[model samples]
Target: MRQIPLALLAPPTHRFDNFLPGANAEALAYLRGLSPGDPPVLLWGPTGSGKTHLLQALAEHWQAGGQRVAWYDADTPLPWELPAHESLLLLDDCQRFDAGQQHAAFALFVASAGQGYNIVATADVPAVDLDLREDLRTRLGWGPSFALEPLGEAEMRAVLRREADRRGLLLGDEVLGYLLTRFERNLKGLMTLLDRLDRFALASKRALTLPLLKAMLADEKIDSDPNL
Candidate 1:
């Protein structure tokens, strides 16, 4: 197996909650199987959805229980070299791998599938469209390939409320409703906005209000630049 790049495979700094209502059930079920041992699993979803969150949650769970866990992200090259022995494997954005990485990833997938070592992958499309090698695609589809859909309005609101609570802030329905109407629809994007707003508010000695949100939204320079 080839060595996966460290920067590309790392998970996010923030915590991902697994209790999201709209999160895929089968995906959670696959994660649950990791309790006793690592099981190879794959999750599919679009950007700004919950793919990374779920990955982080799974990693945190295993790590908390004193299990060895590793994560690989899109920035890393594909066909990740599997560990010599058994350990949880999380390869995100499996489809984004280059041709060589894809071949390597397929081979690793085969090995992981055979051993039932905990493995999870995320892709933009289903396995078929990933341009994966034939055998590897079949193996990914063979088990349960969970698709994470865009969170609905209600679910998104709940997520905002919960995250706000976690941050020791008060988020009312009015604020949530305003954000839902004005910001991007995805939970991930909304969370990003919330995090930024929280920091900005604290620094500027302002409250979380519609005026501030509007100011944040209207800042064309920041709005266009996602990293802002």
Candidate 2:
């Protein structure tokens, strides 16, 4: 398929490069081969499962390739009736919207398919079970689907390594292991924990050690449980 000339579909947003082991490359490969004929894909995973990252990565990849892609969350109208281009549409958190959006999204899917445009959406549930129009449900099943498995311990470690590298933080294995054992196994939780530790360490001008880490975590627990 010819690359679409990028038009003002949507503005770029922030994206992070902290994919777990074996996941970043796989998701990238999936998007690289995508054509308009590829069915509208629905990525189902719990919050902090890297669904957003994968979708954002795909959007960025397409944008960089000169494809006219529109990316937004469920808060926006379905771009069903927009003029067609070599485009990609990324709709995030569709589950939060009303049923009308689902039906409208189906119409957009039809338009995109006709023009060889790509549509990628994400939700907490599988597309088949999403409260959407029947036709939309059927259309969603026509494409390839992928669910991100919850990160395992080693995967979490890998994620920590990647995130630390991205942020240029010197996170030691001992500190990472300590945080992992005491925290929830979700990316958001891990990031929050790391942010606090980094901030506290910086403010106090102290190296991230076990005692400093414990005090920081203990103080965080007072406001509420930091574990999500």
Candidate 3:
């Protein structure tokens, strides 16, 4: 049997509006002010901290302005070509970059400095802790750096309830607490889990609760990885 692609099912999107600021309101505000020729910005956070969301949102914002955006991730293969003209450079997952990617990223930094293009990059750790070459790592700290943090417990609960209410789905207090503790704490992971539960609850004609959520995880086999 052929399986349907997840994109066609529900393509993922990252918009500034969808992000819950929690304690990152100032950081969010900073990103919105970005434009062509802005200095590089470094955003560092653990998984589920919405770093990816913000980076992609930047991409969309630039593209909407009819500015060309060049994207490169640590997972992207070698021979990575830099854009010829001045363009927005979005570098993601800098912590995982190998030696070759590090060299390319250093070049991108030079481009942003010399060519008047804006650059934004995300990593799992702060610049001082980044394990790349010294000069490249130093370049990462050339501009404003924000440490994106996970939402507090109360904030996460509120966000979950707001999302559930927006979707007209019922989730209990127990369910919310369980999600915060048992699953990943990042916004994207929690939202994905909530989306999954929404579909599962509808299909099974069941009221969402802690027990049913556990059952769904058991059947789905995604709970083995906390970051999933």
TM-score to native of every candidate shown: 0.79, 0.77, 0.84
Q: Write the per-residue lDDT of candidate 3 for residues 38-80, one digit (tens) a residue.
A: 7789999888777988989878887888889889997788777
The candidate scoring highest on TM-score is 3
Which window of 10 residues has the lowest lDDT sum in candidate 1? Answer: 2-11
Runs with alpha carbons beyond 4 Å of true place in candidate 3: 1-12, 165-168, 221-228
TM-score of 2: 0.77
Give candidates' CA RMSD values in order.
7.9, 8.9, 3.7
Candidate 2 error regions (>4 Å): 1-18, 21-28, 77-84, 222-228
Identify the superior model by lDDT, candidate 1 or candidate 3. Answer: 3
Q: What value of lDDT does candidate 3 attain over all alpha carbons?
A: 0.82
lDDT of model 2 at position 181: 70
Cα deviation at 129, candidate 2, in Å, is 2.1
